[model samples]
Target: MSVIEKFSLKDSLAIVTGGAGLLGKQHVEALIEAGADVIIFDINENALEETKKYFLKKYNTDVLSLKVDITNEDEILKAKEKIFKHFSKFPNILINNAAIDPKFEKNSAVNKSRLENFDARQWNLEISVGLTGAMLCSKIFGAEMAKNKRGIILNIASDLGVIAPDQRLYKQDGLKDEEQNVKPVTYSVIKHGLIGLTKYIATYWADKGVRCNAFAPGGVFNNHSDEFVNKIAQLIPMKRMANLDEYKASVVFLCSDASSYMNGATLNMDGGRSVW
Candidate 1:
């Protein structure tokens, strides 16, 4: 097959958890562009519907939106059944992209989301969705793929998973490091745990032809304050935060036959942030 043809996910079914979020939406669009039918599994019902409508209208492709709380095993199983019933086959790609990334821009208040003051309840919630949820989805959805003897499991990790979050990037003008709003401990821990899970699943299912890999992406440039954006850009060797679509091509490459030989790999698309 030609190089381009090898990357085509023609007639394949892709399931994307957190399919309505910042990067998740791009994942869905990229998968559809590659000719895969997509199922969007997310907990936010409103965002899920909006994303479903947007993609359906824009791409004019098949998209199944499910209101799934990935932390719940029963919900994952039911969604799995529905997917099998709808497609009449197991999903060829599973994108474990769901995670609780609290928006620092929205909550710029000092001491909020600070590591020292991070609530235990919030910690559990974050881990549940980001880490445990991925595990459940992989166990349920990945099993079907393993049985079929062909599948791709892409875990969405973060650059923070590779290196610690520079609290200075999140520093506000008046607050000290501990008092300032900071990236939660859960985010790094969950992302790191995902990489570990990716390796374990990759090796366990290597003989079954189910390739499991983690995509460690850097910060995407959303509409943050100029101060925050510029601070982050300086930290990256590329001198800019990632554009929302930057990781799409990488996703296509990893999920398709182009990366057939890649397994148990953590592909870092962090634009050199981790290098520093």
Candidate 2:
């Protein structure tokens, strides 16, 4: 195939976890634009319906959306069966994009965000969904890909995966050290663990013609306080948070054959935040 043709995902089927989410929807859009059949696996039934409807009308393509709780192995398997029923071949593109970033109201107790005060239950849930879920999807879906001897597994990591979160960026003036709502430690841990998982899967499936890589993105602008945006932007060399759709093309590149040689690596599109 020619260079431009290598980027085409025609005849490819991609299953994106958290497909109804902000960036998840963007990844689906990118993949569909590249001519790939896409399936969305997310736990939010309402959001899943909305995403399917939006894409159907927008692209005039019947993008499938299944309400899947990735944390549950049974749900993953069932979702897989449903996928198999809908398509002739097993899906070859797996995007491990399901992750939870803790959100709390400003009036809520800020001390809960502190590491010392963080609950184990929250940690377990976050890790299970973010890290464990990815592994399960890869193990089940990728097993079939290995049978075919061709696949791409892309993990959605974060810039914080490369560098620690600057707690100062989340600092509230009146709050004490323990009362500030810093970025939750689980976000960093989950993202960092994803990169490690990417490397592990890449080597494990090397001989099976399966490639794995991580897509690390910096913060995206989604309506935050002006003070917060400026605080984080100053630390990034780009001097601003990314637009919502900015990461779409990069995601397409990583998942397509264009990145055929990029295995066990992280394509960090962080606007120079990790470097700075």
Candidate 3:
């Protein structure tokens, strides 16, 4: 096939966890644009329907939206059954994009999310959804792909996964470093765990024609306070945050035959943030 043709996902099926969120929506749109049939799986019913409607109208193509709690094994299996019923096979691509990144704005009030004061329940929930959920999807949906001897599993990691969060970026006036609002530790742990999972699955399934990889994307802009945006931007070599749609091409390439030779790798699309 020609180089351009290798990027085509015509008639292939992709399951994107967290398909209703900001980044998830972009992944759904990119896969659809590549001519792949997309299945959006998320726990939010309303958002699922909204995403389905918007994409179906915008792309004018049929897509499946299922309200799935990725942390629930039973729910994931049922969703897998639905996919099998509709497509008569497992999804050719799995984008493990579901994770909780608690809004700093909401949690920063009076240092509500300081690491020493962080809630254990919240940490467990985030880890369950981000790390455990990805593993379940890989074991269940990925098993089908492994059996078929052809598929791709793309884990959505973060720049924070490769390096520690600069707590200074989150520093606010009058707050000590300990009490200052900071990125939750769970976010980093979950993302880093995903990279490890990607490498493990990539090798375990290599002979089965299934490829596994991770994409460590940088922060995407979504209307933060000017101070916050500027603070983070200064840390990045690009001197700017990524637009939500910027990662779409990377998604298409990693999920399509274009990345056929790639496996056991973590592609960092961090706009030079990690370098600094």
**What TM-score would you give candidate 2 relative to the actual structure?**
0.97
Clashing pairs in 1: none
lDDT of 1 by residue, 1-276 (tens): 999899999978999999999899999999999999999999898999899889879978758999999999999889888987998887989999998867644335546587667779988988999999999999998888889899999999999889999888877686555567778889889999999999999999988889999999998988988998889989999988899999999999999999989999999988899998
Name the runs in model 1 displaced over 4 angstroms: 103-112
Cα distance off (Å), candidate 3, residue 135:
0.3
Error of 2 at 267 (Å): 0.7
Top model number, lDDT: 2
RMSD of every candidate to native, in Å, equals 1.9, 1.1, 1.7
**How does candidate 2 score on lDDT?**
0.92
- Candidate 2: stretches off by over 4 Å: 105-110
TM-scores for every candidate against the unseen true structure: 0.95, 0.97, 0.96
In model 2, where is the ten-residue run with the lowest total lDDT?
A: 104-113
| TM-score result, candidate 1 | 0.95
User: By summed lDDT, which 10 consecutive residues of candidate 1 come out lowest?
Assistant: 103-112
Model 3 — TM-score against the truth?
A: 0.96
lDDT of 2 by residue, 173-240 (tens): 87666667878889989999999999999999989999999999999999999999989889989899
Candidates 1 and 3, the one with greater lDDT: 3
Please write out the lDDT profile of model 3 over residues 1-276, one tens digit for every residue: 999999999968999999999999999999999999999999888999899889878988777999899899999989988988988878989999998868644435466577777788888989999999999999998898989988999999999889999888877797666567778889888989999999999999999999999999999989889998999988899889999899999999999999999998999998899988
